[model samples]
Target: MSTTERPRILVVGGGYVGLYAARRILKKMRYGEATVTVVDPRSYMTYQPFLPEAAAGSISPRHVVVPLRRVLPKAEVLTGRVTTINQDRKVATIAPLVGEAYELPFDYLVIAMGAVSRTFPIPGLAENGIGMKGVEEAIGLRNHVLEQLDKADSTTDEDVRRKALTFVFVGGGFAGAETIGEVEDMARDAAKYYNNVKREDMRFLLVDVADKILPEVGPKLGAYGKEHLEGRGVEVYLKTGMDSCVDGHVVLNNGLEVDSNTIVWTAGVKPNPALSRFGLPLGPRGHVDTGTTLQVQGTDYIWAAGDNAQVPDLVGRKNGNENAWCPPNAQHALRQAKILGDNVVSGMRGFPQKEYSHANKGAVAGLGLHKGVAMIVMGKMKIKLKGRLAWYMHRAYHGMAMPTFNRKIRVFADWTLAMFLKREVVSLGAMENPREEFYEAAKPAPAPAAPAGAGDKPKAKAS
Candidate 1:
């Protein structure tokens, strides 16, 4: 394998866009056309839509992520991050997970390092906040929620119990809504097993600055979602914001205050900070400015897509905004990656590039175990549904979208089994500390173990 003989295509991230784009490009190209290399900090690409279920014990967190190495067997997958890109020299500085950072030269580049959780300067958020973006966070949240039950059961102090039982969720988008709903369901089920805890004992608070939640769904469906959540004893605080959560004391802008230990922050996501670091032309929100052809503005060989690219949405119109840009969501990201992959190939082969346009199919969200809201747009007709049917729709849509059939079947099996079995509410918080059991067993004995059959005296010698 000589370097001179291979034309290299370097992908910066191994997320949804990066993995799918690389797979599509490799599938289209000839055997020896080019070498595709993907760099990412994580070894697997998580199907983020299942994160809520993963957190709520609906699906195993391990089944929500697909291993990059197993999926992209032909492509060279490097576990690393692209810290810097030298577009002029066609090289990128990659910091490997285990080794020193090195420069990797490529003939072409694909920027798909997806977005991160958008956070505010609210006090105590950095240390106390739990995000719902990836599998690790989802699993951590599941443990945290269950561990809270354990704390409440063991503690006699009212303040500690109240703080442990109260859960505060910021933001009302899909992440925040779905997460709080699933967690509430889990807590309700978990209470049945606890001696002191009851479903009424726990408090679920959802806060959003906007007047409504689930903005992806229309206003009517959003209202239905709010009603469903409120019916489940969830406290919905809209048109308000959190002033501070300093040391777990939450003060709302609407003159409400509460003390809670668990604060899950799912406010929103901003474009990847890595985009701005690349010195590319950025849109107002710091997303890379790309033409409809999916090529970075003013660059022939460089391309971008997914959440990092501000692509034009040709379907909608507005008075002041010209060519409404696509919202950063899974539906758009999945579609954009396909076109972006093809356009990159077209550029490499000197073929004509086509514009990318997609009419949104609509949005769906699961509110709890058997409740949800969905609005499907079909030929100018809007279909709205709620309750168990909508919940099935949400699961059906994302179940098929869970990438590999292996994972899809596993997730479906999880749901199928849930029909007959009660949900698992026990928290394995020790999972985070793999060696904790060993440490406990290895603890120094309060006093050396007495010799077998010894009764308040030293054991006699065998002699």
Candidate 2:
């Protein structure tokens, strides 16, 4: 096909929305009708919900990600980031991992560049706090937590042992609560193998500035989750903020001070600030403004979804809410992706686009092993569950929601094996710096002081 005849669809970001939307659009388009190109910093899209399980060794870290190239074999997958978008010229400047940036012209664009961890100016947060945004962070947290356990067990100093054993998590949202719970469970199980360490010797503290936790599951379930976490010996501090966490020394606004080796920051996320440079209209919170149809406001060829777009909430609007927008979560992202894909195809064909609308079904959260909380919405009734039943529901929902069938089967297999076997409590901290020993071994030996006399003779021979 001639370049002039072929239409190009450039997708910026190979994340949840970008991957699914591109796949849908490719499946619907006829051969040689349009070219689909996906650009992202990473080559794979991470399944974030399973991160906690991965951290706890319930699932493999590699299994929680889908390779964009393998999944979108028919489309061109570019491992780069679109640094700038010139809507007027219909061109984008892609900055690849290597080499220089280049301009890529496109007939249409999809901005699915997802959000980043929202952090504050808290002291030492940048240096000490570990985030839970990706699979790497989850794996790192697991190894770090286990290494801390080893340190505590081997140390004779009471203060050092206490600091190593103390785990502080800041954030009560799904990421914060679930991660702390999973890691704490792993730490407890790991302690069983250590003679010097016990579960009771470790201190797990969860702090949130909000008055309650898991607000998505409603008040009753949120309260239950807080109670359940507290019952597990986790110090739950609500309506309290951290003033400083410099050098692992955490000082809370509630007059509580502790020295902890592990500090996890999962407080919240902000939309990708790169959108500001894209020349698109962004919301007050720095998200792309979109209508119910998931189309960028005041634009015909550009569309957006996922955590980056502030799409209107049809369910809330129907309920007489004036200011209602969809929350940044996996539930809306998955659904909005399908709708956005359909709308893009229809717009390309000069057909009317469908409005993106859906009421939230419910929410589920696993609190490690056989403990959890779930709220299911059936018709107008709300069904709440806890304990083992809730945990199963959480697994079932996420297992099916996990991208492709291959991933679903793999995740299910991980769970199936876990049922018959015990969780792996071993820490492969060396995985992070696997080349350390190799680098040491590979170092060149110093020249045997080319005997000062040997160097002088070599210089005379050269002369």
Candidate 3:
């Protein structure tokens, strides 16, 4: 919250776009030009591309997240969610993690609220389906997977062992494919420590509605990725969808059924549902409608970008397509943030806004350790790579793009050390309920405080 004297720039998110956009605005603006207040439910920004590696135990969860306060010392960081925005009054109501909701006025607003995991009303999904959206989920997935291995090793019953060893993954996009690949790799190594559990005993199945996996990396590479995973003994079910996963019982549309203790859902993501309350022009898919300039369709004071905003794909449109939109990814989010930041500053200073347009720079996907697919699209020439080389390309590209020199160093260090040291496949599943053990062992209530002074010295009352 800033005084009315200085123009206040209220950023509604602190994720990729919000953090970078605020940084850009602060960097471009002079001292006291404006007060930037960023409000987010989290105190840190999660670099999602590293989430798969984090889940696979290849990277530490904390290293993948950048502390918002440390990076934006100049900006007022609020640990809260913006409930609604009254653009008519230029005020946004915020609900902190632990407090009442309040309104904050702003001159320029940044709608970088980001997206949430897209899910359906599938039976038992809400209860059993895991997601890969954040560091917490990644950590939980790692622990749960390892814990399952433990159960499988210790259990004598064949049914119990089978359930513990079976893992089902929905969606064959980057997240789903990468997660299963890394997890299967980790499990293979982890199985060596168990007497009963072996890599051959564990079952890894990937279900996707799409005809191919890693489509963003091109067909040849995608096919290579599928074949490579299959070579590693992973069951790839393309053009297949999961029907129901009731109580850990997975039934696929293709008539395959299995009992899996771990089922990861990474089908897709949708913009924040709270966007509806913001009173902005939204696209058909519930994203903020923004032009190539990244400005809201009918508002000059409010700007939107990233997964939450439907920004026109200027490069794609320029080439040929009449209806083109920027896909939600880190590449565009980062670039869009910088340009959106400059435009916000320009708007404040009465200057013309600069349009944002960046061409697609291909895509990269790492399958497990030493396995991946990369497609480099340079105009007419499309260079493709697979296997170890592609894996290195994926690491190199994302390692440099992880945000902040501090985080980049930490991530690279994690990778460098992983090469020399064996991967730790320990399970800390108790982390989810750290207090459960204590609660169970804790003494019961002290007999309702012993009836107050009933057991005290009766003679003391006489005194």
Estimate the Cα RMSD of every predicted model relative to the unseen true structure.
Answer: 5.4, 3.6, 4.7
Local distance difference test, candidate 3: 0.93
- Candidate 3: the clashing residue pairs are none
Relative to the true structure, candidate 3 reaches a TM of 0.95
Query: Whole-model lDDT, candidate 2?
Result: 0.92
Question: What TM-score, to 2 decimals, does candidate 1 have?
Answer: 0.93
The reply for model 1, stretches above 4 Å from the true place, is 1-4, 317-321, 440-463
lDDT of each: 0.89, 0.92, 0.93
After superposing candidate 2 on the true structure, give the runs of residues whose Cα lies further than 4 Å from its correct spot: 1-5, 446-463
Winner of 1 and 2 under TM-score: 2
lDDT of 1: 0.89
Q: Is candidate 2 or candidate 3 better by lDDT?
A: 3
TM-scores for the candidates: 0.93, 0.95, 0.95
**Residue 398 lDDT, candidate 3, scale 0-100:** 97
